[model samples]
Target: MQPRKAATADVPELIRLRAVALESLGTNPGPADAPWRRIARHWFDERINRRDDCVCLVVGGGPGEPLLACGMAWITYHLPDSRRPDGRRGYLDGIVTDTPAHGRGHARRIVDELVGWLHGAGIHYIQLHTSEAGKPVYEAAGFVPGRYPGMDLITAPPGP
Candidate 1:
């Protein structure tokens, strides 16, 4: 499968693939509410079209075809550090492969492409949060446990 950078026209499919990824993680956003879909579509549309720091990649399928896998990366600038002298880091997310398309190395291909692109763009640090099922794949891809401890601050509950 050939992995390519996603374009604006692929927003809808990217959203669908994101939901599929969420489903695999037990957070499937089923078609129960139109508002959520609308919100997500709008968010994705804007991000896909207007964001220079965000990028989405997909493998397999083309126009009018279902994507076999999809992944995204958001570039962030952090304080300069020894490991990341330029401070540009890549945060990978929404990596998913269609159920029937598993075991075909689609996710790996997408990750590889993303890593190459980020390296070419001078991003040396990359990170991702993966599910148990995805740990092996990521480990095999040369991602070891991170050196720095991670923490999160929940500023608000998940409702709008």
Candidate 2:
């Protein structure tokens, strides 16, 4: 399936796919009006098309149809170091598809496209976080578990 580059108008569907991903990871994305949803919609609208720094891709969503699957990534930089040289890295943020679309290759197709885009951008170091069910797709695209596991520290959101 041909995945389309997500546009501002695709934000809602992208949000829907994010909720799907969160649920698949066994976490609630909260209500539709959750603050994070609002924050994400605004971010996607402004950031999706930048191409230089980020990308979001989706399958389906033609006319009135819902999105079949979606995936996103963003690039980040760290100061040049011996370990990473230029220190540019691509983070494959997330990939999620509607339940009915499972067993199809849509997710892997999106991953392949993202990887191609990253490689074309001269990013050799790519990383991703995926559930056990999604590992095969990423592995097929050449991602292996990192020697360093990831950790996150939740912090209070800043007041507006």
Report the number of the highest-TM-score candidate.
2
Overall local distance difference test of candidate 2 = 0.87
User: What lDDT would candidate 1 get against the real structure?
Assistant: 0.82
Clashing residue pairs in candidate 1 are none
Q: Which stretches of candidate 1 lie over 4 Å from their true place?
A: 32-34, 157-160
Model 1 Cα lDDT, one tens digit per residue, 83-129: 87878899888889989899999988888888887777788789998
Q: Estimate, for each residue in 70-108, the C-alpha lDDT of model 2 and write its tens digit.
A: 988778898988867898888897688899999889998
Clashing pairs in 2: none
Looking at candidate 2, what is the lDDT of residue 58?
A: 93
**Total clashing pairs for each candidate:** 0, 0
Best by lDDT: 2
